[model samples]
Target chain A: MKTEKGQPILNIRNLNIWYGDKGILSSLSFEVQEKQVTAFIGPANCGKSTLVRCFNRLNDFTPNFKFTGEILFKGSSLYAEQDATTVRKQIGMVFRRPTLFRGSIHENVAYAARISNVSRTSELNAIVEKNLRRTGLWNEVEGILDETPVQLSTGQQQLLCVARALAAEPEVLIFDEPCGELDPIETVKIETLMRELANDCTLIFATNKRRQAARVSDVAGFLYGGELIEFGATEKIFTNPQDSRTEQYVTGRMG
Target chain B: MNSLMSRPNPKQKFALQSIALLTLGVVSLLVWNVLKKTYLSDVQVSSVARVSDPVPNLLGDIYFFLSISFLGVLLGITCAFYLEEWLPETNWVRCLIEGQVSILSGVPSLLYGLLVVTVFLPYSGAFQRTQGFPPAGDLNTASLQVSSFQGDTTLFYIAVLTFVLLVVPRVIKATQEALRSVPIPMRESAYALGANRWQVLTKHVVPLSLPRVIAGACRAMSCALAVSALFIGIYISGYTIQPGRMSGRFALFLGAALVLSIFSSFLSQRYPLASTRHT
Candidate 1:
């Protein structure tokens, strides 16, 4: 299931996920292109968040969570007893709610790098500065590197989270409703940042906001009732969606 | 307009307040009785000597308090860590171990004392007979003569061990609660950053939960101190009375125990909130 652009970075085959008896994603199959923004857009409870969580294996912590079928990363089985830590190191995630550790702003951003054994003070400092600069947080927080994140607004905390994820230099980054709690201006800042970030890192953005998906993603997946109804180039998915539900969803008529 | 749900239930509230006030009154009465008994007694010549001779009893209390608190906290935290981190939630063995700790905490303190005495007395007797390590004089020194440990070293060790058993479960329960209180998302974010279980526990969980753990340890310390102080005070005062000694020494023991209990309680209540706010 290679994508048309080039080799597929991730390939899902008839994936199904469940927590207890309740099904979340059913028979979801898609190919994610390399170094591009792939957006999964749908209404609430459509399993878009669950699907992205699967990529980094974050759902393993959820009690009773079980999934069948295969997810291939760089053409290899991602769940054939692969080490979750190694998988997550290469595939990072920014959650909907900003979750910063209890520490200084510098420590928050340097966390991933530190865990990856980047120990030198100079090295950690450079990584922190580089990531803060990358996420456009350097100017705001550079002077207050010693300050805790409780001082930051929700939007700023989210941007710091992005910087934290970026410090790892992951090959892929999953944004699960990254702008869900942001103001319009903050949302715009992150959306623009996502487009620029696509130049270097493969991104998977999950959002219920259709226009944001159309505006930001290179490839779009329209999921409904745990099924991926449509997936293609963002322009085609928006302009001429093959499924009536996707058409209703994209035109703001139905969820 | 106030909804019915928002309205307070006066009947239930009255009942609760009455119960609380009644309990407080009862406790106050008991404390007053103990104080009156200690302060209004005849000032015997031996009473003055007893008052002056608090060094041994004070040392004994200190030894018991420190040993019980240290052992309880160390063992409690270790058990809690094993339960929370090393074992999966699905493991029945973890559940069984936790159940035993819970049961131990609920057992009456008297049962613990009786159990220790019953088990150790025979064991010490057998050891003395078999090895002659402790001479018969040491074993037979259980007279009402108030020496360092109210007479018997074996009895003191047994009491310390018994109190440790009581305190350990409480400490373990507290540590578990503290560990559980570390926000799940915090651990999630750390794990998302590629931290293994050990790294996440050390770097995020332990640091975040430490204040609460300390609070729990303080609570256990207060319990151990209160029980030990009161039991020792009653036992020693009872024996001193038979010997025509002063009961004023009981007041001093009570005062020391009250101070320690108040300090520990204040710490248990204030520490977690303060640390969390500071962070």
Candidate 2:
């Protein structure tokens, strides 16, 4: 694989994360290039989510959760001196389950802009509409922007979450098993969206399903027992895995 | 055989039933006496008459003040919630704030009144000192009148300040608990979307928890109203009423207490009672 010389978008070095004396990930490292899709595929409880959370320092909320690592974004250590608010604005995340605010669907999308000092009504509406349309939720939600998101179907709410994430215009987008809760059709829609999103921003996704990882990811990393067992192109990892574990996982012999 | 068996247990059953009935009768009698003496005596009627004409206007004024106090409490809780979210790194500071809130909630209202008087009244210079008065002149008399008005305004200031402190913690705890009940995942998702802590709280947590927060505020408001009535009663009964005067403040105090109690119960109905099955 050719390594880009200019500053990699995100760089993780010997990142070790722990949750209350329990080591979740040890000496794990990776770099995400600009405008590329990097997928993390692992069995349950392998610390994929933990790794993603470290990007925005969300793990700080957990009591006694400590990490010894260097995570650099745009040549700045995200963990050292960078403000969490700024880091979060640059790297958005979409969770496994659909989380909608209690207000109208429009508010959910416009929430980031509203909070970030975008108070002009016309600009706010444009941002909300553009993001929602990009996520393919505008057609369904346009007539009823004022309606509570709780009224939307599960699929619509998930799509709306994507729209909300995009509203912030984050440079590095992370999806944590984003389609874990979706049906087959919805999952396909999200997978397609991820491909489309990769054209503009670096996309990193964590999924337990190997097939989903193979389908959406350009560069895939197989995590096993808190280690990056294999990392390469998606086709190579799926069809011609160097690691036995990766082959077993992709062939359904083992997770 | 069945008839014989039924008679055999009848005596014990009868004794137990008789005991239960006797207990119920005694309890009801005691309750009735207490209710009559405390809530339904002839003195209560006189108390109502003493302030009947002025009660509505006075209560309207009190309600306006109470609403403002409620708004203050709401704002305080919102501030506290944001503080908790923003100062995650400063756990000790959060603990200190929470501890202060609990202490405020537990402190007696009368003590708060005393604290307010000590801290605000003299330091604010609302009370003018007549130390530089001319010797026995007409000017001294005019200066004394000016000082008296200042003292009156200061006292009113102290009273409102005391009331606000007394009510703030109840509102804070209620709002905090409501916010705490929100699922962490919901908040995390908001943060993941690049929403800042304030944005997540106001946009996601606040709206989701508003129903519960509003319910809590209603409860806290009722408690504050009841406590305010007691504080006013004690203050007026001790200081405001003159021995030979009509004791209008005392009458007003009692009337306010009754109205506040009734209003508390009415507000309570807005939230479902435990006796209601659906809730």
Candidate 3:
């Protein structure tokens, strides 16, 4: 695995998160390098999603959500006097289930642009086309850019979500089991797209599937009971894990 | 399949037949009542008064405006969800906002009108005074005539304000649910891409939740419309229905209602998740 030696794009320190007084993650810490895929592998109910949400402040929406942590983006404390909108603009996200706006395929892709005041008709069209093609959705949706997203298949919708995320020109991309709902073929397509996206943007993906992390990640972190059980290169974590929990999780004995 | 089909008991068949006949009779009686009220009733009284048409029409306009305003309130609530994302540390602020929304939502529209009459109308008067207008000439003073504008028609403004407050919680609750439905992975992905918080919400969260937000707005609007209609019915009941003047007002009101209902129906059909979907 080729690890970039420089200032990390994301620095998380002693992050602890809770929902209604029930701790989900405790004292978690890690660094995500720029332009590389960092996959988080864990079992269900682990703090993988909670840890990822800290980076963008997405967990604040929960009524009783609370956290004690420090998240730094490019060396600036993300939680200090900074706006979430500015942070969000710099990072984009894709979900397991594709969420498409109730509009044309073009409109869904162009949504970020519209909000950011990118209203130039020609520029907007160019962006929609470029990102759609990048995510491998252009060919299927190109012929019907004006058609409603509800008309597309599940795979296409997920691809469209990728295109939508890319439209914002973010420097980091996060995926929460982006292929959980996809079949094998669709999963392969998404994984390929993730690799392509990683060349230009940092990728932080959280998944319960160890095989998936092994397939796409350069650096992998195993989370268990809200702790970072192990962190190393994908090969090392899966084949020669230092911790017993990590071994059990990756070998399918536990998790 | 043939073995499973046991012959029906005579008593059971008779009971089913009687129940079916009773249901049919009830439905036919209700339908007859509707027909009689709509078409067969005495036309002379209806023609001379023409009360129902104008009242419902004018009330409809009030309903339409109230509904649109309710939509705006819902949109505001959706925007509020993203705003809350920025204030993660301020649990008190979040609680306060929620409390305000709840309190306002629980207050009845009529009570809202009363409050508005007490607070906003006086404030508007004060504002007018500060702008160099003579203190609204005292109704008791013989020198000034109290025009309709100066009268208690402030009820309209109060009704709208109250309706907005009433509908906001419903909108917010619906919007919050929709935003919550979006998986956290999607949000994390946006953050990982180096997108800022606002960018993630505006770009990803808002769009994904919009259909649900709109649906909430539709529901809020319908409720506001119904309340406004009821208010108008109660308030306007005693107004002397002058043929010429009342007819115009009534026509305008009905026209507004028709347009709003049509628009609401269209929105619902076009965006079924947020509105009603035509099947």
Candidate 4:
């Protein structure tokens, strides 16, 4: 199995999660390499999104949520001591749907920038423009920064969410099915943006589409029934999976 | 756990509908019965606008009570909005303050009046008797002389304070609900973007919740206005409606209620109800 040369940005070990005594994730272990796109693909109820949410403590609000795990980010325990807000700054998220705040398109992109003490308008505008450009939304949304997010198409809204995440300057970007609610054209746009953004930030996305996982990821982790069934380079997993189940799943024999 | 059934059975739905209709019927019947008991005389259009007996006093009553009610409603909305924004549901302080306010909602209006008489009336004189205003308050004579403005600003103070206390819980609850209606996903998105609680609330939650907050304020103001005349009149008229018995004067009171209600309803519709889900 090939791995990135440097230490992984996220290291998880013996991660056990439960919802009211029913185990959701059982002693799962994985490492998220720096500045590479990692994809977790699985059938429904595989705890894919839950694992991504844990990276930023977004799952902290779930009721009857209990987890015992060591998720280390840059050698520090993510859940043990570091403040959730600060953690979120380093590990930004783009949700399944574009959950934009009730504000203008410009404000949406500049939100994370504002919170991290990017006060000056010149700097904020520059950041918004850069991120919007990076997400391929600059031309479509230019000169309309003040327009509310409600007016944007679903595809544009999703792209704006990507721009918003980029504004935080996150080291790790987690996308929870980023194109789940979007169309094919929007999906292609996001996939292209993800390939470009992987050069700068560690991208970990959870998706139900194995084809998408095969398309973009450098490394693919297949999780099934809360277990990491296989983890390796995406091409290797597709071409010559180490396990029979992985081969069968990749060959469309089963979900 | 098993998921809840989506639709209620026909029998249950029928029962619920019947219960709702019955409650509404009882309320209308009760109001009709009260109106019957009052024996309100005919409205004389000529005297309604003129400086006739009972006209001046009721008009003064409307102005005084409405002014204070407006202030109290505004203040209530501000506090509630701030409390919701600054102190979220996760904050222990919010839980405590909201709990107390919810308890206060259950307190009767009569008890509020009693509290005002005993505890508040002493300090009720916020505005002093201004010069050039007579002490007698010309209610029996003109439509509105400056006389009614003087002699015991205390009554106005008591009425306002009591009205505020009576309706504050509803305002707070309404504001909180409005804030809630802005979608938890929006707040979560804001928080996920690294905004502190304060930043997320002020920038996102409050703006989204503005229309609902205004609606809540209007509802509170209307409640305060409708009840103000009753409570304030009890003291002014020496426990009798004799002062308001004049035919056209009751018309003036009803007209004030009608106009204010219409105004507030108009104000509320200015902003269409905003919801993140709708978009």
- A1-255 in candidate 1: lDDT tens per residue? 133345589999999999778899899888998989999999999999889999999888876789999999987888895789999998999999999897899999989888878899999999999999998999999889998988998989999999999888888999999999999999999999999898888999999999999999999999999999999999999999899999999999997
Highest-scoring model, lDDT: 1
Best by TM-score: 1
What local lDDT does model 3 show for residue B152? Answer: 40
Q: Which parts of model 2 have CA positions greater than 4 angstroms off?
A: A1-8, A60-63, A102-104, A111-130, A145-147, A240-248, A253-255, B1-79, B86-90, B96-165, B182-186, B205-211, B227-229, B236-279
How many clashes in each structure? Answer: 1, 0, 37, 1
Q: Which docking class does model 1 fall in? A: acceptable
Instruction: Please give the CA lDDT of all the candidate structures.
Output: 0.76, 0.69, 0.66, 0.72
User: Model 3: how far is A16 from its true place, Å?
Assistant: 1.4
- Residue range with the least summed lDDT across 10 consecutive positions in model 4 chain A: A1-10
All candidates: CA RMSD in angstroms?
10.6, 13.6, 15.1, 9.8
TM-score of chain B of 2: 0.51
lDDT per residue for candidate 2 within B34-148, as digits (tens), equals 3353335532211211222344436544654665465667676776576545656225555455556655676666545443333444354443432222233433343233223
Candidate 1 — which residues are off by over 4 angstroms? A1-5, B1-52, B117-152, B229-279
Kindly state the fnat score of candidate 4. 0.79
